[model samples]
Target: MSALWDLPDYDDHEVVHFVRDHASGLSAIIALHSTHLGPAAGGTRFWHYADKTNAVKDVLRLSRGMSYKNAMAGLPMGGGKAVILADEDRTKTPAMLAAFGDAVERLGGRYVTAEDVGISVADMQAVAERTSFVSGLPAEGDNAGGDPGPFTAFGIFLGIQAAAKFKLGRDSMDGVHVAIQGTGSVGGRLARLLAKDGAKLTLADIDADGANDLASELGAEIVSTDEIMQVECDVFSPNALGGVLDDASIAALRSPIVAGGANNQLARPEHGKLLAQREILYAPDYVINAGGIISVASEYFAKTENREVDVAEVRERIAEIPGRLVSIWEEAASSGRTSAEIADARAQELIGRG
Candidate 1:
């Protein structure tokens, strides 16, 4: 049971490549979950984990999620993910980037990586110095490129709108209450978007200063991290890390709808059933969070083909996210299944794994 295949999150990943560069103090894992549609494409996450096993477990799950994400987004790519184990201090160096890029290059186009949590366009610049397989490169005006945060936030906002309409019968965010966890890139932007529509917001983050500043800017209320989920609100959006919507969390949720940009929101598949039992309208994370990958994939494909990436086209694809969510929600309602289950089944069919 200690073996890689025995890991609960493994899911028969096609490749799990480990890289170690002692000179650069680099240790990384790249996992490919599928290639049925095309080469595996996902982002590289540079995070500090407690141990190697946890890191591997994270990559395995993330890679599989990416596969589902890409498939659900109707992209011609499979899923893969890379993780660089950072030191406790989270120190990053150019040498480490170069070594990681080299590792990606060794895969020979089997994997494509862009920015994820803790990674940035500047860091991807360093990685691109060693490999052309990187995405999120800076583009000219009105092109599909650069950081994906705004695009992701936009999609989440749209999905929230859809969820609100489907679940709460509200046509607008006006006076709607949203309790948001993690007021970082996606969450903060989403809060601003909702505020523009007159949403009453309650925000929380581990980084108190940033969250406080954002709350001040939007004239929204702020709360503690430990209490965001149980807040009495119309929507509970988790824009932080994954695995927060487990059994106990679902039981404690006070919101009628759960929709956010976080990946793998359900800790396990069974938790989706728990949400259904509670009648909490769930937005499957992969479907709701595909905006980032949509931007990344559009940019990546355009870069490889020596063509100008159409910004409008990318936005058009991103706008489809809400419809997909609504489809799953309605289907689940009529079919007696969870939104997560419906989304997963659709993704599995797309990836040739159903």
Candidate 2:
């Protein structure tokens, strides 16, 4: 176990390096935290962690977040995350995925993995080749898999609307200028949906071409990723990674609403209060981004049980975010607590029960 994982509250740990000699690559590092709720479940993030320590920190924090996310989202699962560090020259191949599949099988469903950053549907398919534990598989019913990005974006979008209504008394997204801080798969899909609802978009990404392409396709303007924080827009959607809104970024924020699909969007809990004071309607990241988990949860349990996930049911359930956000905002105002605290309380209560 890493020294950092020894933090007083966290109670469990597991790490595996799925190496493929044929592909000369490492496939994944799976982490599970089961005691918090039930089995650990989270997406597979494919990126280069600076070291084993950093990777451990990410997987630990992420798995813990998944526990809270599921509890808050009203699901029966706990939290877990898988990471695949790519060497580019040494790894990333079908054989590597097969190796990852073996690693997942070894867990015996104590942790479940799905699609996330740096991973694709094909990768999940490869993982699926090794374990029945994998979700986001082919259309077992009305649910099909290419990626869960759009569905996640929809949940965030609805949560944003909820934030807007709670903070601004607005019911529609019409004419809302939204500055998106990362126009990748999830962010791009979110931009399109918001655009469809008549929200103007100012988009940014490290991939200039990808950003520009999405901007052009959506009739939106492109900005440098850094500029997104200071854009004079109604909503600032940090659709990238965690810690984007730290003391530095929070001090520079110009929007009244901050919402998106990024996990752990706030550098720390106090940032939520900074938003509250700035009158910025900050949607809790885990609460808003629960769509992918909800989808995959259905796949994990429903598909195997041969039960159908009614599309309307899932969509309707997603729409509930706005109402929940509205209530949380009101509660925060009345109690003088950060909305995230309120949210964390809810998650804690749920997890505490089990």
Candidate 3:
């Protein structure tokens, strides 16, 4: 109740752990939620959470959300997440990542790790030095070390189109106004895609320079991070950290559709109901941001080539967002439930059979 991960009502199977050094340096957290489907798999974020308990809660909730996301995305993988507490200084040692790899190894393939947050492609390579349980690196090429955020943005772009079609009764992104908060890897690329599609863009980020750069590049207007939720736009995309849509902020949000690449965007389960009450077409963050998972999962199992990531196929999958959102919206309306409740019900129904 106090934390986003501490949802007492959900029947979740979660395992939370803290581990010390693996090779030399690293504080690691592994959260596994395996009962939802199969072995848990998620990303390793290397940022310093304000509180250790918050980090634990984030990993736990993110892992379970991953289970639901993977299930909804029709992936065979379960859900898990790793958070490595780091100082503000990112120029640490490879030993930290190696230690995280050891944590992954301790799971014996039941829990796999990739990259997220403060983790990067280079960090994955460091983890790979100790274990083979990591993914998201492009194959041998000049662009081999590219981040998966662009792909994620691409998928979200497609999903936004799907959302518009289903919720707004529009067919194209020609004049859609989108407010993207946090112009980081995913949000920056999302801004680019929206600009290319002739969509009006309003960008925001804690890093003013980063946001301004992207805004200038994409011809988007810039907004402050604090003003993002209140921006009058067709869609609101949160690409920053989790739990941004708390009660205080939710009341100020003026967007018609809310979707993005952020994990755990909802501050609480009740926020979903708040959105429903406001008639905001909210796409579940987990459901919309499955591209990175799909990419990494393919790498873990099939060793699929990056070029093989068919944009059309990915777009087709993302285009199903509207159908899924519509179903969840309808179910919520009929049952007087939240979209999250409907989504969790559908996910549990699928995983319960397995």
Candidate 4:
């Protein structure tokens, strides 16, 4: 097993906590990558992992990405992330969630938890039941806002448009072929948005039933996961797992642009350079998928003022994603650097000022 402290870029992390509750069968890790701007805030992800090392590494990388994501989104919060290692079907229970919430509360307000991947609004509500360090609750009374998935999908759609304009020199997604991997919450919403805009869709997901249903609803063609990346399309949108843009996968991609909701999409830092070398316009994942965090931050800020979240304001903030991507794309072209590197540098500068 690799030592957590020895991992590359491990020094960049501000704090890390390992929480275990044997009674509830809960084992989790929370990583706070930075708190220069404000308290660390990000989502809690629950997924079964093959080993503890991989889980810890994921939280570390994701938390760091959150730092960049938050900075680029212009949120005052820093970056932190939590991961619960357990089978969603068998080990997830109210007791487990509450235990996890207790762990979050122990961090004080330095870290806030929300919905991500294996976690949902309902699950966040369960976490909220145990502590105040949670968001994404239903809009019941003065509760913190609801799901941010749709907003995230909308942001990605807008970012894709910016990439298309930068690469294809067009302003519309009309008639553009897009292969989307993962038809879950965010991806599903994104597909609907793209289809409504008259974009051709090829959908893929591990959940065959759900993907097929979405495909039928949107008049899209369904492809297996293995074939999704190789599909002939103008854009390859990965809405599922991270590290899908590794050397092997990058070699097989036929798209001229890659933009989607997956965080930490590059397997390694060098992958960004490879994408740039290949002339594939890549929209940095953190910049594109920041709508969710933006929504969460809005709720957090509203709570400070003792008011309900302003959904309209949140939408307006998310609408800035495309413009931000355009700026980053232009800067990368002028600097002859990967978009990811440029984004990281800008984020670092922002964090430095804080």
Candidate 5:
């Protein structure tokens, strides 16, 4: 493994922590990318990384993305992320969660954690047992706690609409062919939304059964995971992991528009330029995937203020995603830059002002 300080993207971050709890076998990394806006707040991703180096790199990138995402979404929170390097299937335990919670508590509010990939609200609840720096709990009374999947999908749906409008010269998704490369929580809900709008759907996932089930429900054609990216479609939505838009896939992609709920869709920054060169309208992933963070921010605000959560306000904020996308699209078109570059510049300006 490369030296932590020598890793790419390490210089800009404020702090990075590696935690180990021998008794509980909990090993994790938490990265705080920025605190110019406020205390860092992002999700706790639990994945069985091949090694500690991969976990560290993933947290660093994800934390940085959260910073930009929060800035672009007009939120007060800064960016941070946590990743536990253990198999969620067999290694997760209550003791392990409490130990992870203790590690978060040590940060003393510098970083707040929520649920991400391989993590659930129940897991957040377990983390909360040891520290108050947690969000995404199950709803009770007026508290808004639950999965952010649907909200995220809603944002992607809005982003897809904006892309459709820009590329197809129409505001509706009617009869538009969209190839979704993951049918998990976010993708499944997104497919339902698109289906309601009369879009033709092509679905694929690593989990064949889940993908097939969703496809049957939505009348979407099921494609193998490998073929989904190269499929003929008007839009290609990636709801799976990152690095799917790397050199090979970008060269093979046939879609006119690329938008999705996944974070870090572009394998490298230059891939954004490549997509632009190919005449693909690319929605910045951080900008499009801000829906979950918006909901989490609202819940955090309500908790801090000791007030009832405002569901309407959350919906209103999410509804603005399309307009934001349109503005970014216009700016990219006028400036002759990729949308990712434009969004990153805008986010940096916001961070600087903070």
Candidate 6:
């Protein structure tokens, strides 16, 4: 790989710490994009990468997205993310979690760690044993801190409704057909919420059995992972991973709108322009997925201050997601710039990068 600064995803990052604890086979990278809003806050993703450079790229892009996500969501937090390199079997261990926690603790509270991709609440609990700067612990009764997947799904659900109103002239998802491309935590919950709205659904996931089970519950159709993107639907929600909206994929989309909990949906900056050229309404991923970080930040801050978390407040903040998307869409319509560009500029301004 080139110098860290030369990486395309590197965006004037404040800090990038490469951590290794050979004793536990722990190797990770933590990237901090900004702290203008507050302490850099985001989740730690655990995944096995065939090419480790992709891991670097992921932390860089994801940390920056978290910065944008938090700023746009009006949170008093900046952006930071960590990626723990796993082996082919995706092995994880307590010692590794402890080492990672020690790494975060050494940051002197500049970085707050939580759960992401392969990391779980139990994993985070283990990490918290070594660091005070952690969140996503199981909720105290009636509190706002826990797995953020449902919250993220709720936000995406609302944002999709907003897009339908703005682009399809539909107030609700009553009869809308939405093709969802992941049956895991966020995507599955999103499917459930959309189902409650009486939407027609077609679902796909790398885990075929899981997808089939979810489809059974919702009376939805199941498609192969290869076919989900090309399904003729009003919305194509990519909730699995990023870089799915590259040139060829965007060219193949049949949906009028693309929105989901996936981060960095655009493979490159130009892809946003391509979406615009195709006249597809793209819901900037970070804005729609801010729900997770919102819950994490609230829990962390509330714990630090010895105060109770307000569940209603968290939902109220998530409720604003649709309005933000509407504003971005409106600006894109009026200025001829892509929604992604407008959202980036707005986030940059908020982080004092303007």
Candidate 6 minimal-lDDT segment of 10 residues: 308-317
**Regarding lDDT, does 2 or 5 come out ahead?**
5
TM-score of 3: 0.90
Question: Is 2 or 5 the stronger prediction by TM-score?
Answer: 5
TM-score of each: 0.98, 0.92, 0.90, 0.96, 0.97, 0.99
Single out the weakest 10-residue window by summed lDDT for candidate 3: 304-313
- Candidate 2 vs candidate 6: the TM-score winner is 6
Worst 10 residues of 5 by lDDT: 137-146
CA lDDT of each prediction against the hidden true structure: 0.92, 0.78, 0.77, 0.90, 0.89, 0.95
lDDT tens digits by residue: candidate 2, 1-354: 535547533445544333334453564567675546666789888887656566666776787788888887777888888887776453477777887888788778788888989888888998898887787766644653446776788898888777767667778989888899888888988998899998889999999999998899899999997688998888889898887888888888888888888988877678888877777777788888988788788667776677667555677767777777777778888998888888888876787743
Ranked candidates (lDDT, high to low): 6, 1, 4, 5, 2, 3
Over the full model, what C-alpha lDDT does candidate 5 score relative to the true structure? Answer: 0.89
Name model 1 segments beyond 4 Å from true: none
lDDT of 1 by residue, 208-265 (tens): 9999999999999999999999999999999999999987789899999999988878
- Candidate 3 global lDDT: 0.77
Q: By lDDT, is 1 or 6 better? A: 6
lDDT of 4: 0.90
Looking at model 4, residue 168 earns an lDDT score of 98
Please write out the lDDT profile of model 5 over residues 65-103, one tens digit for every residue: 999999999999999999988864647989999999999
Q: How many backbone clashes does candidate 4 have?
A: 0
For this target, which candidate reaches the highest lDDT against the unseen true structure?
A: 6
How far in Å is the alpha carbon of 338 misplaced in model 6? 0.8
Q: Residue 36 of candidate 1: its Cα lDDT?
A: 93
Q: What's the lDDT for residue 64 in model 3?
A: 76
Q: Candidates 3 and 6: which is better by lDDT?
A: 6
Instruction: Look at candidate 2 and tell me the lDDT of residue 15.
Output: 45
- For model 4, name the residue pairs that clash: none
Lowest lDDT sum, 10 consecutive residues, model 2, at 15-24
